[model samples]
Target chain A: MASLIDLANPTRFMRLSAVLLPWLAAAAAVLLVVGFYLAWFSAPPDYQQGETVRILYVHVPAAWLAMMFYSMMALSALGTLVWRHPLADVAQKAAAPIGACFALICLVTGALWGKPMWGTYWVWDARLTSMLVLLLIYLGIIALWRVLDEPSRAGRAVAILTLIGFVNVPIIKFSVDWWNTLHQPASVFRMGGSTLDPSMLWPLLILAAGFTLFALALHMVSMRAEIMRRRVRTLTILEAERLDRLAAQGAPA
Target chain B: MNDLIAPLGPHADYILGSYAAVAVVLVGLAASILRDHAAQKKALAALEERGAGRRSGRRAS
Candidate 1:
């Protein structure tokens, strides 16, 4: 059992990811196939929403992943600030674009689901608005990563931004319940278990699992790329220093 | 099979549109990530090769 600290080393992390990425991609593919079948062909249509309910299969999972990636970033932020884990900021940086994509998917799909159900696509509902804010925060963190050249400095900045932005996570979760909104309240995850029938609940859960695995695979690949990028940067600097030394000695650089 | 599933009726366009949007976005993101990974790996390998060749030449000299 490799500890988190052990995996902080880039070489170790890359080696572990090489073994894990293929399995994750395979599992994600299989789950998505089965889950989509269940969601599309096996499940019964909702009494009210009908075929439009199929949108839930993808939308809910995207929304969940959007929030999940943010939460993961928050944890990575702690790792960067407190533990000073070398890979923490790398993980954080890689996760941002993926999370942002998911957030965009969630918002767009929710709007699509809303148009017919609510008679209009645009609304200023609490859940919708707060979720939009979450997407913006994810984008902001990504922008911050690009603007700062120094990884250590960017890491600190992003970590603080992520922590501060975390205040919106709970707000997004509770916005539906705390305020009267067009968005539906908790049906699947509630105190007394899901109100959804097992027929529907099972497929949604499977779809969510597939989406989670897919996101994990993407994050792992992105992190590996980030590590390689840093290695290239280091090697470039070393070569530049060598050239500078040779020039100082009046040797052909 | 198609009849059993029942068409989305008036909302068919919206529902299908949503799924299409998701597939497009996810595919695009995956492609972008893979492209970056390949480019970075190529860069790292090239840098290492150059550095190694230089070190060997210096040793021979």
Candidate 2:
């Protein structure tokens, strides 16, 4: 925990990520390659959905990351609110767009999967609607960050909204069970048992884990980039101010 | 290549599409990040050099 805290400092974070990015990139490559190969070929087709079942390779993982990324943002929001950690604010802010990307992927892939399997491309089904709402919430957080100019001010405001919006997470989770939707009920992570065969299950599980680590890697890189951007902005502002002072001094009484 | 592509299901398009989409997004992301890092590094280095040059120029007087 102390080491983790130490690394949260931007310089440490940058160094650690520079060292770690290559490994993460390689792992992401290998896992994604193997996972897709197995998902498309080795996994037996759904006795029902047939080949379309392969879409789960992207859809399920994206959906998981969408929600997982939001949870991370909300947690960082909490840290920002409590401790006023600037890096936490930067992380939460940086993660919004990435989470939104995953959420968009989930929504698109879900629709593609549904069109052939559920007989419609768009439905106001519970799961679909809630996931759509998640995407909108991510957008709202991003817009909030953009609208506020002061970094600390924006952090405080988004932290408040994040706490308020945390309720939607559980709502998204339970919507599939609570309503009759064309969407299938929970399969992999649920009570009773995982309905999936192990051959099929292993690939989904690996891809899911890979997506998660991949998201973490992306978030770290993005946050590092954001820190650098903010540093540049500050330097630019300071340089302009110094020039203004020099010009005034040279202007004479 | 046929052996590699053969085991793919009848819907070769969908599998290929997913792979292509992921690759495009990931590559785009890598390129953008590297570009951003390089841009910022060069800008900061330029500013520092200019600042140092001004300081030395003043000291030479």
Most accurate candidate by TM-score: 1
lDDT of 1: 0.90
TM-score of the A chain in candidate 2?
Answer: 0.95
Evaluate candidate 1 and give its CAPRI docking class based on DockQ: medium
Give per-residue CA lDDT, model 1, range A1-253, as digits (tens): 2485875699888988999999999999999999999998899989988889999999999999999999999999999999888999999999999999999999999999999999888799999999999999999999999999888899999999999999999998999889999899989988999988899999999999999999999999999999998888877877888887778989886
Tens digits of per-residue lDDT for model 2 on A1-253?
Answer: 5566666888887788899988887898788778877886689878887777888888888888888888988899888988777688888987887788888888877776776677677899888889998989999998999898878888999999987887888888888888887788899989988999998899998898778777777787788778877777776676676667677889521
Model 2 bad stretches (over 4 Å): A1-7, A251-253, B1-31, B52-61
- How does chain B score by TM in each prediction? 0.73, 0.76
Docking class of 2: acceptable
Number of the predicted model whose DockQ against the real structure is largest: 1
Give the Cα error of residue A115 in candidate 2, in Å.
Answer: 0.8
Q: Rate the local accuracy (lDDT) of all candidates.
A: 0.90, 0.79
Clashes of each: 0, 0
